[model samples]
Structure formats: structure tokens, C-alpha cells
Target: MNRFNWTYIDHKNERHHVGLMHGAQSGNLLVYCNTDILIIDFQVLHSHTYSFFIEEEFCELSIEKTADEQYLYSFDLNTEADTPLNRYRKKLSKKHLWQSLAFLAGFLILVFSLTISFTYWNKYNNQHQFAYGNGIQGRETIAQISIDPESEGKLVSYYFVANGKSYRANTKFKENATPFFKHGMPLIAGDEFVVKYAIDDPTINEIDYNRPSRKQISTYRNRAIERHLAFHPELDLDYCSCVADIAFKMKGINGLADLYFQRVSEEENPKHNINSYKRLVRSPKFTQRVEEKCWAQ
Candidate 1:
């Protein structure tokens, strides 16, 4: 048996305070409203509201939206029966207890495994990070670019040689776009950028370009490009600059051995016309020219 103290106003605007009781034997809620008694089935519409039907109309009651009424009710439902259905329900609750405990044990084991894995990964990362510092300045001898076979569309890898040693790095694009260089510029093969190494051990290396050596390399490359433009007036300064930048970085070259240019124009459609070629020629004799005229033995 459950009882609630409630107050409601009638049609005469008189407040009537009464005790609303649930009869467990009858399985009906007892509501006494102004000299009349109404029996309604107890139902919960949601967490905040309780509902019951009276005279073919739905009635809603909630603590937050109470117009001029209040009620105190118990959440626990009390029932009594010696039926087989009641006995079966009690048996089912006891059976579910072991299943609940097993689920909890599995959840705890998964959490423990993840914790151990994360700890091991953190330890490995910290040890490797400490070994590699800003790398030493090393001249790039060769630069190789290749499309990644494992991925589709604009997945690439850049492999380069510095001081007779090889290194690899990867890049991907959202669209078909040129690979970016340091500072988000277009990256070309044979471009000279600073390489980083560990201070204690030089073998641990990386190509992150925020190094002090880049400024000195850029200055040297610019001087070589100026020398190339002096000898060839027909070549665009911008085109010669790109070639010289790659050449000087690759082999400390003062000028390119071969210079070539091309232009494509369509008379029918101006929009389809390519004004000039973007690629710079890399000559086989370029290294020989650098060895003869630039660096002395």
C-alpha cells in the first residue's frame, strides 16, 4: 500500500486537501476529489510527469507545472501475490545478477589492456624524441619523387640524399596539387633545404626546415642564379632562378649547363593556351660544370 498527500481546487474555487492511496489488492489508485472517489490506473508518462485517464480524457500532472496543487508520492510500488507469475519474476532477477557481474569484469579487463598499451607507446615516443634534435647542415645530392602505389590520388613520397645518406618523407593532398615545400611553396626535386640531426648523435636525422642553415644556403643559391642570368638574356629570370636554386643545392653549382624554354598557344581558343612551360631542364653535364668552375679541389 502506498499513500500520497495531495491538494486540488474544485469548481467552487475551494481547495480540498486529501490522502491519495494506491490499493495493492485492487491494483487501482484511489483519488478523493470533493465528495466523490475516483479510481485511476497509475502510469508514468515521463520522468517529470505522471498521467492517468478520467472520463475518456487524459490528465497530466507534474511538480514543475502544478497550477494550484501539490502531491507527495512514493516511487516504490508495493504488491502482494502468491501467484506462479510473481514467483517466476523473483527467480529471473536472481539469475540476471551473475550475468551483470560477468559484463562488469569484461569491461574492466578491456580498460586495463588499453592503459598498458598507451603507457608503452608513450615511453617509446619520448625515448626517440630525445635522441633527435635540430639536424646538422648537409648538402642534398639527389632528390627523388614518386607516386605512392598503396594510395589513390595525390599520395606521394619524397626521398633525398644528404651527405651520401638517404632519407624518406611522405605527403598527401586533398586534390591533385603540387607538393608543398618549406613555408608552403611548391616543392621541386633537387631543391636544397636544411636537414636536421641529433646534437649528440648525427645519425638520427630529419628534414624539418626550421633550421639555422637554410638562410646561408638560400643566399648562396640566389648568387648562383644571378650569375646564370648575366650570361643568358633570352631566359626568363624567374625560370633561371628555379633551375639555379636546384643546381646549386645539388652540387654547389654556379650556373646550369643546359638552358631550354618552350611556349604553347592556341589561335582558336585563347583559354586553352599554355603561355609557357613550368618545368626546368636537369642536364647530365650539370654536375661536371659545378666541379670545373665552382668548387676547387
Candidate 2:
């Protein structure tokens, strides 16, 4: 059983005491005005409103569900019956509702603004750290490249392994950017490149095109070719080696590195079922080179 009480004053300056007794499980309710019992019900299974008169003045008692799914009891007293106290109560209720909505809107705006500010701040902080912090040399594998729909700039996505974990990131280059867009030089997916990343946070990194020398490119190309031939034991080593050398000559170090990294990525994810070597063999340049260098007498 739960008990609730309230006090009210009427138009004639008369004092009144309003009290209620509720039996939650039994659905029994008792309402009292001063010492007089005004209403009684034994079947109050849900929230309800009760209206009664005291000294010719109107009064209302309501039970309703609150925000936390709990029941609340409210009492109101009116000086005249013609005043329609419920209408006034409804107006006050609407005022509170609007106030609550305004408060919520302001809170959401503040949170959104803070989120945007923090994101920019974090990016700026990371750039600063990468620029001045002690960074270690790391190898990055170019995963994909596409033109940004909004900026129409070339976006290069890449990944690197650090501390035995892989981290992925992307950079954007305008169409006129040097080296990347130099005549006869085309950046493609699966290219391996040099990168330096903050030792403490691998996410802060950038590509360094001048980092790889010709010798390093040869080493990468040879290692990749060796792995590919091992994986496909039936492939002719002379033909494969000729094709790889032709590809390096055609695309330069970046091109050959791309082929090597693409093979590495494919090996790492066998389910992808991609054969970059076959694709290379099918290209006209490689086919022509294979005939001229490996088979032509």
C-alpha cells in the first residue's frame, strides 16, 4: 500500500486536506478531502483522473505514468467550476514541454559542436606529432586508388604493419601533383612505397617517394617473383622472370613495386582468388616481351 497527501485552499479562504491511499497490487484507491471520504474504488488497475467538489469549489486528482515508468499522483484545486481548471493545467503542461524541448535541442547542439571541434583538434595534433616526433621507417603497401567524388582528386589508400598490427590510412593528391602525376608515371594499386610513421602512433604517417633506391626496387621485385613462382610451381621461371623485368622496365620502380605488393596482398588473403601474375601475362606488353626475350630465337 502507498499513501500520498496534499493541502489546498478554496475561494472562501477555507482550508482543506486532500489524502489518498492506494493498494498497488489490489488496485484499491481511497480519496479524502479533510475528514470526509470523497471517492473510493477497488478496481483502479491503471492511471485515472478523479473529479470532486469541496465547498462548492472544483478539485481534480490525477494518477499518471512518469518518465521512468513510475506512477505519480497530482492534485489541483480551482476556485470556480466555470474556470475549466484542466485547460489551464494543460497550458502549463505545454509550456513545460516546450521548455524541455528547447533545453534538449541546445544540449545536442553543444555536443555536436564539441565533437566537430575535437575531431579537428585531434587531426591537427596528430600532424604536429608526425612532423616533430621521433618517427621510424616503415614500408607501406598501396591498397587502392580512386578519384574522390567530391574533390575529383586522386585518393590513395594504403596500409602498413607496425607492432604486429596493421593500420590503414589514405592521402589525397591533386591531378597536378609532382611525381605522382609526372608524365609517363602512373600510380596504381598494389604498389609498395616508403613511409615514415610516428614510433609511438603508427596512424601518423606519410609516403616518401624518394626513399626507395633502384637496388631496393630490384630486391622487392625479385622477392615477389620468387614467391609467386613458388606458389605456382608449374610456371616457367624464365618466362616469369622475363615478364617481371619487362614490367619493371615499362612502369619503373613504382610500377614493379605495385606488382610486388599486389602479390603480397593476394597471398595474405587467398580467398580473394586474384592472380595479378596472370593479369600481367595477359597484358600485350608482357606477352610481346615474353615472346621476344624468352621464346624468340
Candidate 3:
């Protein structure tokens, strides 16, 4: 059986709240539950003899999962009664990297299956080009900032014009792929020119490096960025703060933490499988603030 102690330490070391989570690495972590209440368990896949202990009652825990993996589980303890957090957590899904894309991939699956599913789900009947998506067009390489140098780019906001629109997807360097890569020593600012965004949905998002020793496409990619000059270049560089420009040019969700189903009432859920009560009581993100935010009295 997996074993560990969740301990609270008031060590005379520092001040900030520190959460030390030690668990065995294995098949995947599970929100193990009984019939009574929801309970979380950190499944140890990698090592042997795992141990962690906690004082407070924690109903939630996080786990890692790769693509194409589904979790299967069953209740072990005498499930039933008013188990509260323990029972609820069982209904929650393990935190899947498939869900977070945790590790960065330069040439990622750019678009996931869900991204397409949702897009069409809304256009089932009236598939006509109805200026759909709150910022769906934001997918096609809206901006590409060369981190070494500084620049600014523009992407028009159509918020009032449409809802459910997704903005530019912030991607990363892929681990398996040679991947298009760049870095900004100076912080990238909202006003910085990244990419001019020439084409519409479904465009060539490329770059050039000019390294004959490495890849021939480097030169082409470099030239492409060179030619991607912004039409009305903003008066800003990578590190400058345009704070407002950011929300306008980014995707909506990041990971499971954002998965807390707060207002999925109008989320266009085609599955209809969305459980209202499960999301309400089981979600780790749903931990009440009034009880959570207060200091130990």
C-alpha cells in the first residue's frame, strides 16, 4: 500500500507558506475515494516504501498523466455515509499532462482535439462563417516574438462583437522536436512586436535561423520573421508593460487548476455528461475561500 505522512512544520527557517508534497512516483496519482467521502491518494509508480502524513483533512491531491491514458479505479474502504470531501474527490479526474501540456513542445500539437471539437460544436447547424469564436482566429500564429531582440505586434480585439473567442495560444519549445526556439533576455512586454500575423486561420507559422550547419529552413524562417513587420507597430518593446494588451492576446485555460467548473452553465458542453454536483463538491479548486483564506484562529 502507498504510505506517507502529511506533516505541518513550523521550522525556524522562513516565513512564506511552504507545501512539501512527497509521494511515490508511479502509474499515476489517484483521488482514491470510499462510498462515504472523497479522499485523494498519491499513487507511487516509481519508487518503493513511500511515506507522507498530514494533520488537516485534505480532500484533494494532484497527479500526472500523459496523452491517451485513462484512469480506472474502485473503492477500497467501506464507502458510504457523510464522507463529504472524501467521496467527492473520487469523481474528479487526475491532473493529466494531456490536460496541461506540462512540458513545453516547440512544434506541439498546436491544436488539440478538444480545440476542434468545441469549435464545431458551436457551429453544428449554422455552420456559416458567422464571425464565430471569441478569438478562435487567434490560433494561427497571431504573434511570434524573437526573445533575443525586442519588437511589438498587433491583434485586433473583437470582444464585444463575439463571445467564446480564444486569443493567441502561448506555446513552448517541444522536448522531442528540434523546435523553433528564441528567448528574450529582456522581459517580453505586451507592446512588443512578435509576429505580424499575415494569414488567417490556418497559416504558415514559420521562422528562419540561417545556420547552414544545422537546418536549411533556418534561413527561410529568419527571413519570414524579418518580413513579418507589424502594420501599425506599437510604440513598445518586449519588456515594456502594456498590461492590457496581454489579456487580448492569450489563450483561456492553463491547467486543471483552471478546470474548476464554476460557470459551465453556458460552456456549450456537448457531452451533457457534465455533472453539476460532482463539479460542485469534488473539485480541489472548489475549496471554499471563507474557510481556506483565513489564518488559523
Could you say which candidate leads in TM-score? 2
Model 2, 1-297: lDDT tens digits are 779988787646888889999877787899998889999999676889999887766888898856664678899865435655656666788999999999999999999999999988986677665666534433343322333446556565666677787777766654435233211224444545566666666777776555453444666577657755766678777765765677778666544544454544454533211365456657897778778886852
lDDT on C-alpha atoms for all candidate structures: 0.46, 0.65, 0.28
Scored by lDDT, the top model is 2
Ranking by TM-score: 2, 1, 3
Greater TM-score among 2 and 3 belongs to 2
- Writing each residue's lDDT as its tens digit, candidate 1 over 62-109 gives 323134433335322112344444465567766788788888898899
**C-alpha-based local distance difference test score of model 1:** 0.46
- The C-alpha local distance difference test score for the whole of candidate 2 amounts to 0.65
- Give candidate 3's total backbone clashes: 51
Report the error of model 2 at residue 192, Å.
Answer: 1.7
After superposition, which runs of candidate 1 have C-alpha atoms over 4 Å from their true positions? 1-113, 116-146, 158-185, 188-206, 209-297
lDDT of 3 by residue, 57-91 (tens): 23223333334443222212222334544455444
